[model samples]
Target: MKVHIHVSLKSGVLDPQGRAIHHALEGLGFAGVNDVRAGRLIELDVDDSVTDAQLDEMCRKLLANMVIENYRIEKVGEKENA
Candidate 1:
């Protein structure tokens, strides 16, 4: 089984890195970008025995910082997961 994890900062939390990127884009003449948020993607390969609950647990335990980040799980094709 192939699982995809997207981890990102929660709203209202400070994101200095994202703000820096937004500023850099404006410096490079990129306009109309109101905001920017940075996040992470994690891909996992596992046996069919892995359940959605287990995947969520993995996110909570290590993949994402539960205090300020949220995570979403998705299933992807074998080729994409690879």
Candidate 2:
């Protein structure tokens, strides 16, 4: 099975990298580029027997920093199709 974890900053967190990208976009003459927030995507291939509780634990422990970030996990393969 495959696990896809998306980690993103919570609202009100300062994102300097996202700000820089926004400025760059503006410089390139792109209009209406309101705000940019950067985040991370982590993909893991694990045994088929891995449970949802275990995956949640993995995200809380390693994939996301619970203090300033939020994460959503997606299971890939047949589970996804279903």
Candidate 3:
């Protein structure tokens, strides 16, 4: 199974990398970008037997920082991103 973990900082958290990207965009003359928030995508190829509960645990335990980050788990069909 293919899984995508979308990890992002919680609201109100400071994102220096996102800010840098936003500034760079403006410097490149890409206007009208009011704000920018950045996040990460983690793609995993796990066995079919990996249950949803286990995946959730993986995110909670190690993939995301519960204190400052939020994560969404998406299960995708093999053909979807291929």
Q: How many clashes would you count in candidate 1?
A: 0
Over 4 Å off in model 1, which ranges?
Answer: 79-82
Task: Please provide, for model 1 over 38-75, each residue's C-alpha lDDT reduced to its tens digit, 9 standing for 90 to 100.
Answer: 99999888899988899889999999999999999988
- What TM-score would every model get versus the actual structure? 0.91, 0.89, 0.94
Worst 10 residues of 1 by lDDT: 73-82
Each model's C-alpha lDDT?
Answer: 0.92, 0.90, 0.93
Q: After superposition, how far is residue 10 of candidate 1 from its true place, in Å?
A: 0.4
Clashes of each: 0, 0, 0
Residue 44 accuracy (lDDT) in model 2: 86
Q: Considering lDDT, where higher is better, how would the candidates rank from best to worst?
A: 3, 1, 2
Candidate 2 local distance difference test against the native:
0.90
lDDT of 2 by residue, 1-82 (tens): 8788999999999999999999999999999988999999988889989999999999899889999999999877656633
Error of 2 at 6 (Å): 0.4
lDDT of 1: 0.92
Q: List the residue pairs that clash in candidate 2.
A: none
Report model 3's TM-score to 2 decimal places.
Answer: 0.94
